[model samples]
Target: MSQKKTVYIGPFIQCKTLTDLDICPNGMIGVDEGGRIAFVLRDERGRKIPEGDGWEDAKIVRIQDHGFFFPGFIDTHIHAPQYPNAGIFGKSTLLDWLNTYTFPLESSFADLATASRIYNRVVARTLSHGTTTACYYATVHVPATNLLADICQTRGQRAFVGRVCMHEMSPEYYRDESVETALRDSKACIEHVRKIDPEFDLVTPIITPRFALSCNTESLAALGKLHRELDLPAQTHISENPRECDLVRDLFPESKSYADVYESAGLLTPKMILAHAIHLTEEETALIRARDAKISHCPASNTALTSGRAKVRKMLNAGLNLGLGTDVSGGYTSSILAEAREAVFVSRHVAMDEGDEAKLSVEEALYLATRGGAKVVGLEDRIGGFEVGKMWDAQMIGLEAVGPETTELDQSAGPVEVFGKETWDDLVAKWVYTGDDRSTTAVWVGGRLVHAKEGFRL
Candidate 1:
């Protein structure tokens, strides 16, 4: 079946690098049948469309005055089953919150029906926020975990689904029964995802050992070995909370630090994505950088749980790949735009404690939400940004306008307002600070229209 070729003409904005954002007031992008971006014409400058190159018959989508095309967000780390528990944690920090809110809800996933309802909503909700790619942590139940992958595939979102491996320090009823069961069940989920998406073009299975405190040595080692054997990307938590760090120290006395636990278990590698590294030591940062491992900076979750601010500037200075995560339920929001705003605020907190050098600019934060996240999930070449040859994962962002003939109906264009005088940079800043999912008028993944608001036609 041949796919249709579409040409999108609009104002395009994207992070060109860590410090620069490329904004083309008049741009044209061509996406081929296979969902890959085939050509990008920046600032076409009144040139007519090239004819006899198969572009004459292509479908053209033109943007309105108030809207622009931006690359879709990438959520580097999120808990799929925790959607129901979002914003319910009351004064409970890491360990207690896990026992009270996280575990019980995740355990209910043994009932596949309940899992389906939650997984479906989370996938849809994240897609509405323009998250085209996500790295998801599913529960220990293999069926439910596989269902999560299936839901993402059906919803047309890119995802990495993992069956969490936690064989110790968790409630007996909810945890994996043994090391063998943990490995076996994890393998089953991985194979299920493989069978569903043979080439893993849209969905892949990740090795997830819940965290050092939840898993024993044997299970961690086995999961690491599986990570090596299958050459899969792995995700886990590290140094999220001070007490969690203390517990890791006590649990693995032989290891030098919390990061050492994974390093000693043979789990630290370039393919690993470690979440919430808020309180890592100098040596730990060096170790992670040396291993070429990536970090998912979950600022919203860290602040919500009263976890200390992560030194993102330090991590970036150390040459570590960093990305944003909703850490939903803990973070209390599904939108990566919210995460990007939170990232700015979190860096300010760091700057207050450790000078202005610790701060992060809006451009850097947006980069983390897109390009940096692509690196975290090991999809640097496939997703993120508006480059030719990358997948067409993007969103249409519309901002409101205040004019002389303004009426009540015109006020519904979301929180961002354009006075018709702001620069492109200022417009992006307004979107970052005030825009919500409402600003995401439409979303597309792999060049397919996946979500659109009312009045937004494909």
Candidate 2:
């Protein structure tokens, strides 16, 4: 078991802050053992009102005058094996880029030693970028996938890792064993790591079908059955590119649409997360909402590959569970704030051109990054908000650097006064528009300080 620790942080802000509406002026979340949270509310006498263990008199360890702490961002679609290609850009479409850059780069994860070195960098960078949890797709290499899973578990970040299962029609070098072998290996991986307590609990084995074109009908059906039998979450790409959609149509002629391919195979369940629902017909949208599945919007990747904008506003109106993703490598950066900004910008652009009856709001986007994302990963009840009794998975962004006061002063005074105007919405707006990894000064997962900038280690 990991060591027990208690820490306090303050002078922060959060928009739509979840602590309370009555007296709680800001979102102040507390974390205790097992990554649990205890939101503090003081009585009239100023005595601490407790929610869980170690609530009273917890020692203060760090203080940030201009920090805004909120629930850490959750990435629902990213490739751990593709970490080496984090900044690969300038592609016109998905299939073209996959062939030109993505596949060639993914094939490298077959090396376990190589995976070890890369996984560390991926986690370090992701933590630095304020992502406390991620849903990662590793290569079919079981050992390499295992290495990646182990790193996430030991390092105390929530991760849903799929052992990149693919049985037919992929590049020879990157493809995995037969369907039966893939199933058995995936099940074994699930049971293997689930025994390691918190780290293992943080790690879940998701059944990943590379895509419709990559997996044969038999393979998709088998994995779908495995997900139902094991009660596990499943993920895959869907309707991401027009060419890929056409390929899916050619591959599965009987299906009316691309979404039907998975629906027919019994994979589109509430437990499933479909990445990039950029090309959904009304029927597909109905089915998606009916099944309660989620859409993982990768705005950066969509624009980077010219796949067109996802109907985010329509998806939300249809009552679909939706979240944002960097789709890094495909996306140039791992910042969810960047994803949020692009999500709004692209949605408005699409609405203007197509004149779709949908609008995206800043509050809606922030909700997607937090609660909507947690739902996509099947952790909505336990990990999304700064409420009492939720997991204390939070991050602190220093708003001091990007406030109005800095602009008011000349470059001589060091500009420390602007931080006071950094309200929750102001902080988040600045974060979405101007922030990067440097803005993230501290990260805490399950009540433990996992990442901090300069001279502090947990």
Q: For model 2, how does the per-residue alpha-carbon lDDT over 192-286 read when each residue is reduced to its tens digit? A: 66765434457888888888888878888888889899888999999998888888999899998888989888899999999999999999999
Cα-based lDDT for every prediction: 0.92, 0.76
* Candidate 1 lDDT over residue span 1-458, tens digit each: 14688899989999999999999999999998888899899877796666766878888888865879999999998999999988888999988898999999999999999999999999999999999999999999999999999999998999999999997878988988889988889889989998999999989999999999889788888988999999999999999999889888898999999999999888999999999999999999999999999999999999999988999999999999999999998999999999999999999988998999999999999999999999999998988788889999999998888896765565556888888899999999999999999988889899888898889875
Q: Give each model a TM-score.
A: 0.98, 0.90
Give the best candidate by lDDT: 1
Location of the lowest summed lDDT over 10 successive residues in candidate 1: 404-413
Candidate 2, which segments miss by more than 4 Å at Cα? Answer: 1-28, 42-57, 197-200, 354-357, 401-423, 456-458
C-alpha root-mean-square deviation, each candidate: 1.1, 3.6
